[model samples]
Target: MTDVVSYPKGDLRRMLSVLAALESMPEATLVKLVAKTGLDKKTVSNLIIQAGEQAGVQISKSGPIYKLENWGPVIKRSGAKMALTGALNAPIVLA
Candidate 1:
């Protein structure tokens, strides 16, 4: 089985950068993202999907233009420091 713990940090960081770049230019295309991020087209595509899973963000495409939905910076918190485990779909109740 593929180890969920083994998720690549490099791809995460690259996607975060793509998220950042998308902020300034909200109407960029897939090809334009490759040039803007200096990441391969396939790599960018994969990162976009991963970003959706890890965070509650989405990248949508209309024709050739792409845009971000519920977009923001990805803040990585370690298990020890985090208040709760599992996806954010659960309630975030504080003690």
Candidate 2:
């Protein structure tokens, strides 16, 4: 048997992007897309779970696959108010 290795640093923002990308793809391709993040597999997996929770998204894992649940509504509401008000076009930063 070989010892397992893990990624030391994880970026939640990157994980969120990965989740958004996966939302439009088939479940079977999750692992492949996550791998492209260049994070250790286990690290990426855990980050996915944590990010999902923070965003009020549900996630499940079976064997090597991870799935998101009810993420659409959560994503839709995230910036809806800002979008409607054209906040995205304004140059504003939170302090």
Candidate 3:
């Protein structure tokens, strides 16, 4: 049996950027964002799924649109420290 290594949490800026981009274009798929964000497809996909669950963001597999449902608290806490320096409005782009 091979040992499985756990990856660190993804950059939230990348997540939010992807989400923001998704807001404008909901038909973008995880694969597309993976290439756009320069993150591994699996990592980006998992982060997107996690964000959906934590922020109540609904993502349709058939389409690229994602709706943020009650995401105030989740977005606030989703790895903001590294991306934002004690501020939410900072323009930090995660890769």
Candidate 4:
């Protein structure tokens, strides 16, 4: 996905990083997202919102845990994982 699009950099990259992290686990908390992406709480929070609104990623929150139900409009689950894998030059893991 990202290989086909050169636009996913900077904040977009960060958002993808967030998505990648979320995709790696069944559910994650804000602290876990911050830890996994090395992003602050606010940034992770905003990215999650952006992913849900703009990208159509279905992220359901239950208390502090966030679960990624759909990969959203930008890409599919496998594509997002592969894209982030290429972007980081490593596999994305949150657990």
- Which candidate ranks first by lDDT, i.e. highest? 4
lDDT of 2 at 43: 62
- Per-residue lDDT tens digits for candidate 4, residues 1-95, read 12222232353667877877887777699988877777779988988998888889999999998998888677677666566656546434432
TM-score of each: 0.60, 0.49, 0.53, 0.72
Q: TM-score of predicted model 4?
A: 0.72
Give the lDDT of residue 4 in candidate 1: 16
Clashes of each: 0, 0, 4, 0
Ranking by lDDT: 4, 1, 3, 2
Candidate 1 local Cα displacement, residue 58, angstroms = 2.2
In model 4, pairs of residues that clash are none
> Whole-model Cα lDDT per candidate?
0.59, 0.52, 0.55, 0.73
> How many clashes would you count in candidate 1?
0
- Between 2 and 4, whose TM-score is larger? 4
Comparing 2 with 3 on lDDT, the higher-scoring candidate is: 3
- Which is the leading candidate under TM-score? 4
Q: How far is candidate 4 from the true structure (C-alpha RMSD, Å)?
A: 7.2
All models, RMSD in angstroms: 11.3, 9.6, 8.4, 7.2
Rank order (by TM-score, best first): 4, 1, 3, 2
